[model samples]
Target: MRVRTDSHGGHGWERETGGPPGRAPSAARAWARAAHPVPVLVVTGLTVCLAVSMGHSPGSAALVALAVFAGQLSVGWLNDLVDAARDARAGRLAKPVAQGRLAPASVAGMVLGSALLATGLTALCGRRAALAHLLALVSAWVYDLGVKATAWSVLPYLVSFGLLPGVVTFALPGSPAPPPWLVVSGALLGCAAHFVNTLPDLADDARVGVRGLPHRLGAAGSRVAAALALLGSALALAGAARLGGALGLLALAAAALTTVAGLLWLGSGRGGVRLAFPTVLLVAALEMGLLLTAGLPSGAAG
Candidate 1:
């Protein structure tokens, strides 16, 4: 069989089978990879910590963590499911969904189950919190459903992330809505995430017709904008004494280096160096976790 051309126009023999020749992924591995386990685990840890910091009991924190994990799982799978066709066209065999290593039926089943569990857990928080969370999930779904190709792509991120602080706080036994600062700051970071998250895929994304905000910005522009937004968020949190000095400095330095690395990679089109994008985004997510924890008003927790 002739190997398809991958994104780089290389003969995609290594990618043609979703693994090296004669080494197809097992069902479990396929599901795991398709769901993007790393980010889900990181977010789960952060959610647990943020829940505890907000004065929730340990049990509540764990429940919150589980809920968030399931939701993230659902979203991750949904993203792959929605993008499978495009990814296949781009010869992105690293993705289990597009490479057919995982059956779409299995992923669809996982999505339904995970989404239901997420909804049930959110409902446990409160009616209002559940409502907000559903809207947030809906926004994510909207992004996956083709809005990501349009100028309106960032809107979903804005809506979902802006509502996150409210979702967290309102889940408190009797807490009121989150303050506007938290919402606005979160929206900014979320917007930044849209930029940074798309950088590694910019070339392929454009080829596959995904012209989101980052695509419009191009790689270098996206990197710089992402860094600025991340740094701005750090500054916003720090100015209010929300971010402690150590985390703030760490975040700032990481964001700066991440942008620089991306710019270099964009200029050179190197392979190994492209790994910087996801690594830096992981660091930025930690910063986001700190911000989430900081925005919570302690008095509100029951």
Candidate 2:
């Protein structure tokens, strides 16, 4: 998020101005400076939720977070690297890579090392878990590489999020898939994320020749899709929570109401409400994840 500003007041990947000096490797080594950590944290938080929901040990939760961090870091860095030129062209100042504050080589090195570490950590989680999580990572990479320009971009998010619950469940001794509702709700949440996240970038992306689903849908269509997806996720969570009695149902209702309130609040785009839409959906997704955990079998071991 720390962009090196160009004379044109844009990120400077297309220009040499404000770029880190070639000899100053130290500049590229700063973790906080080289990349935006918000998305990484969000993804890693989901991994932690997975471990906890599956009744895994604390160590497992930490390990899951670490593995997810690696994969998210690699994919996120790749996104920046691959889109540096496009971002510069779009005058985006939010990408460190596009700003030239971060060296592509350094970011690429991090990607390689983190991906290898992610593989090992996921393997430690168990072979089935490893495969599922790795597939999720691959799906992300596919989006970063070439899929983002196509209408099929939503496919990766669906694949990855659906596989995520399996990753957690399969890490146990029996290697079970998560309940059907869990997978369905998770995928819906992810699909909603695709719409919501892409809505802000639709114009910029289309300008840069990236005609993903959001671009094709246009602003209004994308918003409708995102809203519908979120509502569907809420219903799925509510259904899953029904078996747990009134308390669980109450929680689910609360989450749904929150989602509705968010939609209404976002309608006004009051102050920063529009900017908070993604975060609101993320919280709802986390609530849905918690509801999914309610049905986890007692035998699922730490």
Candidate 3:
């Protein structure tokens, strides 16, 4: 029996004899994998935490969580669907669509469904909040559609993440804007995440002709860029806390330690390279924690 493999890595029936291919993964399982659950959960959980910290009622926080979760799911599914061919070519079997376990059409349908759900949910929050949330979702979709392969790839991350705080703050009674420091810190962290996230996939990306900013920077350069961005985010958060105070000092010290640890790991050769992404995530979490602790200042909230 001669087997044929499609571009999506699906084994086609034999050319000589009509026979069934191997069983595909169940739709539910494939859809779950295609949704990129970890990042979706992390982003949604973080948004909910931000809403709660900003004094949102439990119901408001739950709404924020649901909207953000649906939005993230759409983003994740769209990304997989858009990159299905590239991922398959690069042997990225971890992606359900690339492995042929999930159909691109199914992913596209989920993307539309989740995006509409997110939009409707955000609208219930208020006009300003809905606008901010919708813009963020659009920015992420732009990245997935084409910007991820361009030099301006990080632009979407900056725009999306920077607007994230507003998605919560604007849902407040007055629809107040988030503090400038919070927006700046979020943008910096998002930039760092973009660089760090691209590190592991640099090779595969290059193979598929994706030459984003991180890909052009190369591995070591991307690591340095990520470190610098993290430091900048830390400083932004510290400023928001008013650097002369104890809280500010604590934030600075923690930031310094995290940056140093990440740098050391980067310099530790191949064995420690695996720690890079986790280290960046740790710094991001630290920045978010500091932002939560600082809360919304009276003047800033107004």
Candidate 4:
């Protein structure tokens, strides 16, 4: 993902440099600029994986990506809007709107429009996909509204990831059913992401009273959580693949090994965001690859 610089840097810096207090509108504008597009990237990536795994046509995949992006855009906007105060307090220089670069009302309007578009596009995927997206949307809203501040922050990430595979499955033209293992893998991926993603901001979050799962657990706890979640996901995938057919066990094993390698790297104190985020992204891409290659003729060996 590209770095989204918060627009508040200039004005915020000026204020902190002994200028007058910044206006709320400046903060909101900055927040909007910073928080936008995050959903598009994450949602689009997941949709692409689904399209590949389900063997959807390019056009169909693009449409699904659009819908997913819209949904996530709505979710991301609300997240920043609701957390503006907290972000401001936390000295989150990365949030443009929160730092006073855009208006909250304008951002809300954008979110509403995007949500409407998402709802319409979801219908094209059929009722199943729409329902799944609805559930995920609600979960995301809950997470942003106040859930992230509680012990349940991790729950949203897990649910979001789990729903992603389902979204891909249902968005296909035919009745494509995602394997139970795939869903489990998505959940595990989400859990790992939750832990690793929070590592960089744990200190800032704690200072701002955002005691999320990572903040509560601390760095060590977060690492342990990432390890357990990834391992569990691998076990589930392996078991499911073995049961589905003995041929894919090797693929599952490879995924497990890759996950273990990543965990080892993360365990090393030297690992940073550049290492962790890319590692997780690669692992996710590999899982999606395994799902796509499940029925293809291959010579992959454990």
Candidate 5:
């Protein structure tokens, strides 16, 4: 049996020399890949955790998770659909749409469906939560539409991520506002994520005429910015925890060590630049863990 490989570098589909052809399974895989599943799952998981921590009922927490998952799906799909032409032009065949393994129209349809589902689910959480999430979604859409190529690229991430905690807190009974520290920490971490996420793609982005804040900062500067943002986020969380009487010294220590190690690794000239983003992610996870343990506002507790 002979297999037909996508010359654009996408997953190869199975073709028989004289038998039945296979395209469905590979196409499905491509669709899934195009969804940007990793970040979608991560964001959804974090929302669920925050909902549970904020004293939401099990049903409400589940609703928040489903809503966030749908919203993330919409955002991811729209990103791919909007970037299809650019990706194709840049020879980014790893993108299923760019490689012709998936149709842009189909992806656009999914984007609409998921966005509607997300809106409906968020409305069920309550008007406040719904409004906050709607704004967040709009911010993400703005980034996909055009802000991603400009100096203000980080604005959307700051707006969207800072609203995330409020999306959970407001869904709870009485609709209490999210704590200031939580919002600040989330915004800083989101900024760090933006810088780190853009690092490896800086060259590709430049080739495609995309020059966000990170592009302007250059790689080394972006790395430093990401590290500082991560450290700032950690400090904010730690300060909140300290006010709550938990000290948070351990988490702060860990974040500091992780930041130092990451910077040192990159500076060692051992091709460790790839580890920079992962380091920021690790600090984010650590901050989340601290938030779960000692950073939850008393008013937010069930």
Candidate 6:
């Protein structure tokens, strides 16, 4: 069936009942699409970085890694759930059920299952970590429900991202509570994420009344906000390094490079399609690198 064209940049595919000529989206394909593996992969990478940076025990590290996967799954599935109508209207091939490859009911089931898994696993981490995980889920839901459309779209990111490192560290046996600087730095990175996440869909979002901080700022303003976030994060990390040592410096450098690269991408002549995916990829990388920095030996980092 035909539907309105996507105002944002995403692939266009015709919805057919018979399925793509010879191709099929089986249980594996459905799972992949439902899981939205990219974000999960990025989060996993971040967990590793954190483990190395902090010299976490293997068991603790494993739990944190699992938390990342569970967290991303919750985020990804919820995104699809909230956007299902929009995807239907836009005839979005990028979405699982929207392309007629999977059923909406099935996707909903996946969301429920994943969220339950996340909650159970998080509880094992500790009361504090579990609370953080719950907070992240709540923040995401708030964003989906219309907080994101308000001035508060940024709040969800701040709360959610800030809690991440703490949750990981909390999982460790006998480790001190997460440092204030790490959480603060994470909040700063969240601000950047708010901008970067909204880049590709600004147009479609506007078209469908999904205006958030990015829409309010417009493209130029959004880009500026993104750059400033990077700068601010870098400065914070640099200061952190002064107090904490070499790993801080390396983290700051990584944050700087990440911000610069994002700004460069935004400024490029390339259309949103080409730019958005890469930007997302870079943002994920930056987060992972920052987390990993804590593990690098002074000499190795230098």
Maximum-TM-score candidate: 5
lDDT of 2 by residue, 84-198 (tens): 7888889886667776756677678888888899989989989998999899999989999989889898999899888877877777767776777768777877887887777
Residue-wise lDDT of candidate 5 within 92-177, one digit each (tens)?
76787666666566778999999999999999989999999999999999999999999999999999989999899988878889
Question: Candidate 3: misplaced stretches above 4 Å?
Answer: 1-27, 241-252, 264-268, 297-300
My TM-score estimates for the predictions, one after another, are 0.79, 0.82, 0.86, 0.79, 0.88, 0.79
**Per-model tally of clashing residue pairs:** 0, 0, 0, 18, 0, 5
User: RMSD in angstroms, all models?
Assistant: 5.9, 4.7, 4.7, 7.0, 4.5, 5.8
Q: What is the lDDT of residue 123 in candidate 2?
A: 97
| Model 3 Cα RMSD, 1 decimal | 4.7
Error of 5 at 158 (Å): 0.6
Q: What is the lDDT of residue 48 in candidate 3?
A: 70
- Stretches of candidate 2 above 4 Å error? 1-36, 241-245, 257-273, 282-289, 292-295, 298-302
* Candidate 4 lDDT by residue in tens digits, 1-302: 12223455543423433545555555445544555564458658867866765677788778878888888888888877787777777767666546654456666887788888987898788888888877877787788888888888999988887887777677765546667777888899788877877787788888878888888888777877887787787677666543454455566566657655665565546455446655666666656556666631111111
**After superposing candidate 4, which stretches have Cα over 4 Å from the reference?**
1-33, 36-39, 173-176, 242-274, 295-302
| Residue pairs clashing, model 2 | none
For model 6, the superposed segments whose C-alpha errors exceed 4 Å read 1-27, 242-258, 261-268, 271-273, 276-302
Question: Candidate 6: global Cα-lDDT?
Answer: 0.66
Runs in model 5 deviating more than 4 A are 1-22, 241-248, 264-271, 295-298
Candidate 6 lDDT over residue span 1-302, tens digit each = 32233344332223223335543445456557756786677657766677667776677677767866876786777776677677777655667655545555665777778778887887887787777778877887677667877766888888887777777766665534666766777777678767866776777777766778888987777777777776676566556552444654665576567656657564544475346445545644654565564453322221
Candidate 1 error regions (>4 Å): 1-25, 241-297, 300-302
User: By summed lDDT, which 10 consecutive residues of candidate 2 come out lowest?
Assistant: 267-276
Candidates in descending lDDT order? 5, 3, 2, 1, 4, 6
Give candidate 3's error at residue 169 in angstroms.
0.7
Q: How many backbone clashes does candidate 5 have?
A: 0
